[model samples]
Target: MWFRRDLRLGDNPALLAAAADGAEVVPLFVVDPTFATAGTPRRALLHDCLVALDTSLRETGGIGLVIRHGDPGDVVPAIADELDATSVVVSRDYAPYGRRRDAGVADSLADHDRTLRGVGSPYAVDPGQVRKGDGDTYSVFTPFSKVWRRTGWQHPHPAPGDDVRWVGAGSTGVVSDPLGERPVAGCTLPEAGEGAALDRWRRFIDTSGASDGSSRSAVAAYDDLRDRPDLTGTSRLSPDLKWGTVHPRTLLADLDASGSGEEGHTVFSSELAWRDFYADVLFRQPHSAWENLNPKLDTIEVDTGKQGEEKFARWCAGNTGFGIVDAGMRQLLATGWMHNRVRMITASFLVKDLHLPWQWGARWFMDHLVDGDLASNNHGWQWAAGTGTDAAPYFRVFNPTLQQERYDPDGAYVERWVEDPSEPMLDHRVERTEALRRLKAVTGR
Candidate 1:
């Protein structure tokens, strides 16, 4: 089985399909230097997950994961040819780069009479599966999410049965494993791999309302406390979801069993739907990854000169002087992660408050966040900037001070990350006025 985003063995449809296809399955992971730009935190998380997966392979199936390095189109087929494997199986990749890479690998495999089959994907509902009555995609999230829920999901597939063994067990000699090297970022990353993912999920499941009414379970208080970063209100599973350590199907099943009718569970499930919605948006409109979904927003004058750069640099280093924005960036720099509420606050400041292009901030985030998936990160930036599918209105700029007052009411989140806070880089009220001026000029409203 060729592993990409889908890393874990449990509830992996691709692995089960591969095992069912052949008596022995070869667990192959290619460390393509092509993706070397995928940020230090992401690389480090991937490396740790690979090490964890290798351990699982040996303990469970008496074999190790095959470590290969090169372009996947060349390396995967060559490895298959060496093993005389009949076919190569993988989970579907929806990202533009991944889609192109998978196609190339498939063509290469076909040249040698090997079949390349894709089974499940990283999402609950595959892109293009849910559409309007007119066979059109929803440009808004609310309608899309409703359709996504009504579409339903298949049951989680069990992991590969105990009978499946490794095909390239002893004969294949490994070389040049990137997973063996440590990432340069040096930020202490979150727990990595399948076991760690499950353990974290268990803790999240067992978590209950605290005495202060702060901490809560996934379905218990998420609706109430999710926007409160000080409470650890949101699930820290995005990194795992990004790496597919735990499939959305698995999480969905558990959430459904826990009672999807409850408000907290329903809202949490809707968030999952949003993830799928963004993926679908990116898949169907690949160029939307860089450009705005609504073209008219391009008319908004975005600052890109040195002055804007200086402002942006401060925002990135958590020196924007806005307590919430600075807190989020520092949290990201120190832990390779940040709270979702803070993410929105920081993104809004960069695009609206700083008047910088959202894409620049998106790229910066991709180079920093461990859980940065291109679809989610870029679209999220666009959402804040009012330039994406299901975008918020252009006038809906987030006021940093207001956000701080509302979300960080106790100032706990801000104090935790910003030790020596700086003065406001730009006056929030002034920037808010300028941002609205630019929006009105562009929209002609």
Candidate 2:
């Protein structure tokens, strides 16, 4: 069984089906060299997740995950040939590179008269599954959410029965440290693998109830608290969900059982739906990963010169004049993640204030964020650039200082991440005026 984003063993369709076929499973993990060339923080996180997966499989009496380093198009077929395998089963992936790689592998396996089978994707609801009554994709979020809710989900399948046996391949004897010698600086990652994901869910539920004795209680207040940067208000599950450490069905089932009030659960569920929405958008329009989602906005001018590079560096280095923007960037650098609200604020500064292309910011995030997902990150940048489906209008720029005052009221989040802790906060009204003038001048608006 080949694992990509779907890392967990429990409730995994492909792994379970593969095991059910009654053939000895050669569980394999290939570290694609192209992935290393990308060298993003996610690469390291993937390595850690693999280590956790190997440990989990060991406890279950399966052979350790075979680690190979090469282009999967070359390596996967070579492995199959060496083992004389009958079929290769894997979880389906939706990303551009993933789709291409899988196709190549399938063709190669076909040459050997072996089949390559794909189970369902990582999402609970496959992208583009839910649409309007007219059979067209819903572009706006409100209508999309309504239809998504109506389109419910299936109960996740259990892990395969233990009767499944394994076939071992002799170790490739390649000593590799995929995640490097140590974890990234300032990143204290959560425990990884299936056990860790389930444990975290349990702890979240327990602590949420400890104060109110109701699973739904915390959720009822989620909408009110989710925007606050200083509080641990949002579920810190993005990283797990991004990496497929936990299945979305499992999360949705828990939320459904919680009975969190209509508004709160509605809001939280909508955010989850956005994940599927972006994945669908990417699958259908992969070029939007590099260009504007709305082609009309491709004409929107951006500064991509030395001046733009200088501003981009400032933003990346967390030295932007805006406290909220700098704080968010620094937080991402330090922790490999940033609060959702801060992400919007910083992204707005990059596209609006700095006048740099959104791709620059997206690439930087991809390189640093452990939770970085291509679909989400690309769509997020496009949203900030006013070039995505349901995007904020081109003129609706975020006022960073006002955002700080509103979301970080006491400045705790800023103080925690910014270097100059004592600098007087910039005036939002003043900064907003100046930023607007700069943007207008650059775009001839």
Candidate 3:
């Protein structure tokens, strides 16, 4: 089984399929050099995850992950040829780069009379599964979510049941670090691996008996307290989801067994739906990864010169003078993660207050977030810029002061991150007007 995103063995459809016929499975992971672009936190977390996967394989299946270093197109097929394997199995990847990489690997495998079989994906409902009656993708989230719910998803496959034979890394004829050295991440990352992931999820949904001494599940209060950065009201599970330590199907199944009718459960389910929706959008329009999904917004004026660079540098350093924005940026710098509400606030500050391109902020985020996925990060930036599939209207600019007063009323979140914030770089009122003027100039709205 070729492990890419799906690291955990439990509920992994592709892994189970690989061992279905009682085949001696070789658990392989290629360390692609291209992954260097991922930020340090992500790189470090990935190393821990790989080590954890190896541990699980050793404990349960009497084997370990085979570590190879190179382009997957060459490494995968070469490994297959060496093993004389008939087929390689994997969970499908939907991002532009992953898709292209998989296609190349498939062709290379065909040359050796081998096949690459894709059985499942990282998402509960794979991209392109939910569509309108006309079979076209949904442009808006609500309609797409409704169809997605109706389309539903399969129950997660159990981990391989049969005691299967295995190929050890020593016999693979390739050698690399079993537990790779950790990259130097600037901030403290959560514990990495499948056990950690499952533990975190159980605590979030209150499935685990241990609650960190809290009376309520984080999910129970998610709808009410999720907006507050001061409290631990959110799941903090994005990193796990990004790494595929626990599948969305597993989460959904747990929610189903719990009271699915609760508002918190319903709201959290919708959040997962947003993840699927963005993936679908990127799957259909790969260029939307960096380009504006709505072409009309192409003419929207943004700063890209020295002035913009200075402003962006200030934003990146968390010195923007706006308490809430600074706090959010600092949180990201410190933890490689930020609260969802603050993400929107900081994004709007960049696009509307400082008049910078959303792409700049998006790139910065992708360089920093441990949980960053291309479809979610880029399309989310487009949503803030009013150039993606959502109703984040360009006319509705976020006011940083009002936002701080509303979301961080006690000033605790800002205080936690910002030691001494500077004066506001630009007045929200002035920039809000300038932003609307630019939008009107582009589309005559």
Candidate 4:
């Protein structure tokens, strides 16, 4: 079984498919050099997860995971040839790059009369599955989310049985560390591996709310507290989901069992729905990953000159002089993670306040964020920039001071990340008017 995003053994459809005929399953992970562009926190986490997966495999009476480094198209077929394997099983990938990579691999495998079998996907419901009566994709979030919830998903697959056999790829030893000797980022990272993911999920969902003698689970309180940056209100499950340490179905199942009808659970489910919504959007319109999904919004002027570059550098270095924006940027720098609310505030400031293109901020985020998934991160920046599906209106520029006051009332979150914030880079009043003027010029509104 070839592993890409899906790292865990449990609830893995491709793994089960690989072992269906009682064949010796080779747990292989190809280290593509392209992934090196991801932030150090992500690479370090991947390394840790690989180690954890190997330990799990050994304990389950399987040989260790095979590590091969190269382009997967070349490496996968070569390995299959070496093992005389008839087919390669994998979880379907919907992202543009992944789709292209898989297509190339399949073509190579076909030349050798081998099959490339794709089973389940990382998402609970694959992209393009949910649609309107006319079979068209929804450009707005509300209707898309409503249909997504209705479409639902099947129960997660069970882990492979003990009868499944594992074989090591030690004989064809060309294995090399994908990350090489590069240094990981200095910031603290979340614990890696399947076990850690499950533990964290349990803590977040509080299967038994009474476990901690609290009347409500974290999911129950999620609605009220999710917007507050000062509290750990949101589930810190993004990285886990990104790496596929835990499946979305597992979380959904837990919610269903714990009374999903409750407001808190309902809100949390909607958050999950947003994830699916974004994936579907990206799948249907791949170019939106970099270009604006709403082409009409493309007319809005964006700064890309030396002044813009200087401002971008300040924003990245967390010296933007906006308290909440600075805090969010610094938090990303320090932990490779930033609160969701702050992400919007920072993004809005970049696009509206600084008059910079959302792509500039999006690229920076992809380079630094541990949980940065292409579909989510780029679309999120576009959403904040008023240039994506269900985008926030261009006139709705976020005032960092008001946002800081409303979300971080105690100023605790700001204090934690911004020990010494600089003066305001640009006046919000002036910028907000300018942003609106630009929008008017484009839309004649």
How many pairs collide in each candidate, listed in order?
A: 0, 0, 0, 0
Cand. 1 TM to true fold: 0.96
Q: Which ten residues in a row have the lowest lDDT in candidate 3?
A: 207-216
Candidate 1 — which residues are off by over 4 angstroms?
169-178, 207-218, 257-260
Report lDDT (CA) for all predictions: 0.84, 0.77, 0.88, 0.86
| Candidates in descending lDDT order | 3, 4, 1, 2
What are the per-model C-alpha RMSD values against the true structure? 1.9, 3.4, 2.0, 2.3
The all-Cα superposition gives candidate 3 an RMSD in Å to the true structure of 2.0
Per-residue C-alpha lDDT of model 1 across residues 198-301, encoded as one tens digit per residue: 88777666656422355656556778778887777777899999999998888778775333466777888888988999999999999999998889988799
Question: What lDDT is reached at residue 318 by model 4?
Answer: 90
Candidate 3 lDDT over 1-445, as tens digits, reads 9999999989998988888778878999999999998888888878888888988988887667899888998999998988889999999999999999999999999998899999999997899999888888898999988888888888878877648777756545545444556789888899988899988888788732222344657786677788889888788889989989989999998775233487878888889999999999999999999999999989788999999999999999999899999999999989999999999999999999999999999999998998988999999899988888866988888889999999888999999999897888877888899999999999999
| 382-413 per-residue lDDT for model 4 (tens digits) | 89998887658777889899999999999999
Cα lDDT of model 2 by residue, 18-99, tens digit:
7875777877888777875553567667778888887777767455777777899998898888778888899888889999
lDDT of 3 at 181: 68
Give me the displacement of residue 371 in model 2, in angstroms: 0.7
